[model samples]
Target chain A: GAGVSQSPSNKVTEKGKDVELRCDPISGHTALYWYRQSLGQGLEFLIYFQGNSAPDKSGLPSDRFSAERTGGSVSTLTIQRTQQEDSAVYLCASSPRASSGSNEQFFGPGTRLTVL
Target chain B: SQQGEEDPQALSIQEGENATMNCSYKTSINNLQWYRQNSGRGLVHLILIRSNEREKHSGRLRVTLDTSKKSSSLLITASRAADTASYFCARRYSGAGSYQLTFGKGTKLSVIP
Candidate 1:
């Protein structure tokens, strides 16, 4: 009965550093997604993983953003060489059904990343 | 690029009063979903209306979709103070390989008790 969970509710790091944000999806959920929200930018999709297939990274802003879902359960989003503009709330979500249906995603408490 | 716009940007209403939010998208979609965010944290899905569905209701929430106009409306009847939060509308593009949901800028609703 647990919902999606994320680690490090808040993170503060200097520019040029790297940070990793973790996400634990609900049990039996095969779809996982990462998104970030910042002032003026709204919510931007980062990456998505479905089942064992390839992950969709189209929405990733740059090469610095990367995510991997292991065993189709947990996912980690890593931001390399974090820039000041990367400061935002990183959110994770999971859907019970993988794809091809009316997917309603359940979100987790986001990790607020601040680059100074 | 299928992102939409939510009207009013911000709205304040007294408890027990009805609240309405409008959204407009830029592309064909399979379905549209509404979500509520508290303290800018996780988004709690409110409801989903498919392209084929003209309207749907859940509890005090009523959602209507107009695929022809690529717009939708979410109306909350008898809103409560607890309903004060940021609401967003996300749409799932209609086609394969497009599983991502496009989100709007969101509408901030303040329910004054």
Candidate 2:
């Protein structure tokens, strides 16, 4: 009964650098999501994957941001040429499904990305 | 654009006292969920209230939704000091064959013992 897990707990990189954050969703969880949280702010949805359907990329802030959920179990969020404003905590969450009946998402310990 | 906005950005109350947080959203939603976060880490799901339901309760937490007003409220009874954390209200809407949640700024609750 492991929960969702994320890698790199903390990452510090220079501006214009690229970083890849990883997430491992709970077993059997078919819905995965990525979000960014700025200091003292709310979570900003980034992307979402459900089963084998096309991923929702409407929330990605810019073209530099991209994510892929391989094998429908693990997801990777990639931010290219990171900007100072991109510095924030990246969170991952997963749920049993995307249905309204089971939409409660379990979150993972986020990776704190600092673009200096 | 953020869909939900929470009121009273911060709140302070004594232990054992009740606390209330409110959220207002711009669009119609399928459900509203509340989450608690500590130290800016992962958020823990607190409760979820559907648009059809007026009110729901779990333990000391009570959530109420008013689809007509596009608003909801979360109340915690007999709160303890451990309840201090950031409480966020996320609006769940269905679109593009998926359900996604948009979160508000959140309310920072400080329960003083």
Candidate 3:
């Protein structure tokens, strides 16, 4: 079975530029999540999508950060006006469902973004 | 802000020795999951312990959860060099009929061969 996967394993952009990171979740996964891992820091939750319900954007750091999952599968995270502070590895994970006891997110290889 | 804090930041042990990592989190959680990451790659799920459960074991890995203290510890016995990696504890919480996870900074473990 295919696990979660991200595209453009690495990306480099200039400050004030915009970059989009893509994620393909596992088949039949009803829940997807995005997180950011900065240098020497923990994984920070970004956004979440479950089935057809409204996505949870509470973890998004700023208005420049946004994401959308289409057809309950693929998701794209867009960072507008990229800053050096946004340089980090963006990770995507998916799960069968979003229940307390059964949810175990499968992570992707992640896309490392560098803003200069 | 992150919800959990991992102690010792890093650990190094002999191949035949055991490795232990501890985590402390704020607020209540429904479950705590342990994950291993190698070389900054994707994380692999190791074990999950529910709040009601005090301890759980998986192969050479043993996990103990103390809700009273909001802390958890992971022990890997007879660790091999292959086990060297970053270990993280993710806290799961449910709100508004949805579940979310918050991860700790992680402990970097180095198993010497």
- Least accurate 10 contiguous residues by lDDT in model 2 chain B: B91-100
Computed on C-alphas against the true complex, the DockQ of each candidate is: 0.78, 0.87, 0.81
Q: How much lDDT does each candidate structure score?
A: 0.91, 0.93, 0.91
Can you list the residue pairs that collide in candidate 1? none
* Tens digit of per-residue lDDT, candidate 3, span A4-25: 9999899999999999999999
Structure candidate 3, residue pairs in collision: none
- Considering every candidate listed, which one attains the maximal lDDT? 2
- Give the candidate order by descending DockQ: 2, 3, 1
Q: Write the number of the candidate with greater TM-score, choosing between 1 and 2.
A: 1
lDDT of 2 by residue, A7-79 (tens): 9899999999999999999999999999999999999999999999999999899999999999999999999
Interface RMSD of each: 1.4, 0.8, 0.9
Q: Candidate 2: where are CA atoms >4 Å away? A: B94-98
TM-score of each: 0.96, 0.96, 0.96
Where in model 1 is the C-alpha error above 4 Å? none
**lDDT by residue for model 2 (B51-81), tens:** 8899999999999999889899999999999
Ten residues in a row with the worst lDDT in model 1 chain A? A96-105
- Each candidate's chain A: what TM-score? 0.95, 0.98, 0.97
- The TM-score, computed over Cα atoms with residue i paired to residue i, of candidate 3 is 0.96
TM-score of 1: 0.96
DockQ of 2: 0.87
